[model samples]
Target chain A: MSFDLGLVIEYFPRLLSGAGLTVELIAISSLVGICIAVPVGLMRVSASPTLRNLSLAYVFFFRGTPLLIQIFLVYYGLSQFEAVRNSVLWPFLRQPYWCAIVAFALNTGAYTAEILRGAMQAVPRGEIEAARAFGMSTALLFRRVILPRAVRIGWPAYGNEVIFMIKGSALASTITLLDLTGMARTIIAKTYAPVEIFLAAGLIYLAIVFVLTRAFRRIEARLNRYLLHESA
Target chain B: MFDLKGFGDQLLLGALMTVGLALSVLCVGTILGLAGAIAKLSKSAPARFAAETYTAVLRGIPELLIVLVIYFGSSGLLTAAAEAMGHDGFVELSPFAAGVTALSLVFGAYATEVFRGAILAIPKGQIEAARAIGMNRRLVFLRVTLPQLWRVALPGLGNLFLVSQKDTALVSVIGLEELTRKAAFATGFTKAPFTFYMAAAVLYLTITSVTMVGLHLAERRASRGMPGMRG
Candidate 1:
């Protein structure tokens, strides 16, 4: 019948802690995801059949399933194995944080790999051929030409991925990692005011995502300036 | 280790419910999406504002948040509004309906983008040529633009549908008896969380894989007369 502002304020500390964990998890997983994505992306677009197929399978499996199921499978399913449970890995599986990170990293890697692969392929064939004509070695060609160009092409979509990952970080809560959404749920259960607290957490998420998108836009504009001048 | 006999019927019931809800959401989402897409494409300012606001709010927030907000918050809001309208009875919003509404809103936003892109992608030349032949706007669009537009739009729409279908799990947060929620419930009851989740994972994989094949076939059929295809 009524909403209370005071109760929302009361639960602010718990919500802050949850938000902190969400951000931390996103930061770590994003870094790990990017590392794996780069090579997987390269492999997906590689010339060799064996490398390409393997990468294809990797992307296919993760992308096909929902991230929720994937997280559960890793945390619950993987731990079912005696070798895994009895092995040194038990301590890691016992932690929800590790499971969240692993699932997020793997899922994000698949999507990011595809995004990067498309970006890599969009780099002009003639440009690469010209580099080859100049007698540049493979490593130098990639370092000087391919990587920079791929990043520039991929930056816009990469911004989309950043927003996606930020939202995705909320899923960690379902695994009992006490992310913002989880904290909101807990607070609502305690205070019995669902709208106010969830709204607060959501607003905070919106602010973070808005800032991220703006930062990406600035970097993108700076990158595109060179292209604009070249075209003009 | 798998207790296949005891829970098989219940899991089947859940799977059917999951598919049922996915289709229901898709229908609702399509209606919302068409309206939003039209509104966004309209010339009037109010229409544009309404559509843009819907997209911005829905897109900026996570789908999970939308689900939670609708499932948890909307009932109270609805009840209050009903009382204000001189209604005495409780206006109940079931978790299933709330889940559907949440999903439709989220899917509608993405679909607006897809539909807008598809409309923009229809070639101007063909429309012009049809007009030159004295065809009316409706006729020209139906004959010239719409035909080619489907070929262009189908893949993107298919992808959207697949993603939306998987995304139905967001509703699980609200206790819908969908695949994810069903598995979660069974996990809690059986104390074999891993087995249930694995089954759920495999089921999702099966759906996506089968859909992939279906999409491939559809693409081939749709691209039959296209100029630049390898297959």
Candidate 2:
């Protein structure tokens, strides 16, 4: 009936370590995700049928299924393979941390690729043609012309993806990784105060998302400054 | 490595449970979504705040966390309530309820956006047109606004449903005997996790792939006679 501030404070230190783990997982997967997304996004819009189709199927499969299912498939499914055990890859595969990262990265890559593909299309075609007219090489044309526009267009959505990856790290708990959500669950089982712990964790997540949304909004404002100045 | 007999039954059960859960969740979620979307667009500021906050919280949290929160969190709250009322018994949330609630929360959030977007997409002129014909506000919304909104929202709702259907696997965390849980149970019994998980994956892919075509058909049918909508 009465709110228990002292209980919440007592558990705050315990949950802090788990929050740290959650941040690290999200940060690692996010950096790796950009790496995977840029190339895959490029491939999705590539001139080569082979690359495009393969990339298309990869995006389709990953984005279509639940991330939890995908995580289990990678963690448990690969462990079942003899060749995987016999191969040198088991060293990486055997660890839950790496498996979680790999799954999170692949999952984020699929979603990010779609975001980037849409952003890539948003870049003005005439500008790319203009770059070509100036005898800009393909690499220079992409680096100078395509990526900046795509990056600008995709930043808001990419910012949402950052919030998403932070939340998705909660699933690593299922694989026995003690992220924030997982720690909260353990704390709840011990204290039987699920609402306090879970609610606290949710607030932590909300705080992270709020910060991210603000950062993205600032970037969007900065990007639109010239339009704002002209209008004024 | 494959346990043919068990695999047959588990896959069959998993598919049926998954689809049944999805259909149930879809119906509940859509109802919640429709009301939420309407509330969101209503003149009341409190309504707007409630709607916005619900969607933001639901969308921001992982489906898995939502599942855990309600699965454990809600029950904790309920039990505390009961004890306070001097009821000396525990209240357990059936895994099905947890699954449905978790998914519906996610679905409703996405659907709120879809429905709100759809409602906004309806031209102001059409409402004016209906008003010119002496239509009431209810008549304007129902006769002029609602029909077009469906066509605009159907593709998005379809996508949300597809996402929710896969997300039903999240109930497995609470030991629900849906597709993933059933597979995990089978693996425990058989000790050969590969075959069962592969079978579950194939079943998921089949459902998702088939639903995509159905969604495409629904979108095409809904968008007929709309202008500049060749996609």
Tell me, by TM-score, which candidate is best. Answer: 2
Worst 10 residues of 1 chain A by lDDT: A1-10
Which window of ten consecutive residues has the lowest lDDT sum in model 1 chain B? B1-10
lDDT of 1 by residue, A1-232 (tens): 6778787788888888888888888889889999999999989978899999999989988887788888888887787677888988788888999999999999989999999999988999999999999999988998899989999999999888878888878788777878988888877777777888888888878877788889999999999899889999
- Work out the TM-score per prediction: 0.90, 0.92
User: What are the lDDT scores of the predictions, listed in order?
Assistant: 0.83, 0.85
Q: TM-score for candidate 1, please give it.
A: 0.90
Q: What is the lDDT of residue A170 in candidate 2?
A: 86
DockQ of each: 0.63, 0.57
On DockQ, the candidate that comes out on top is 1
Error of 2 at A48 (Å): 1.6
lDDT tens readout by residue for model 1, B123-208: 77877889999999779757876577657767876777787777877778777788888888887787777788877766777777
* Predicted candidate 2 versus true structure: per-residue lDDT over A108-166, tens digit per residue: 99999999999999999899899999999999988998988898889888987888788
What pairs collide in candidate 2? none
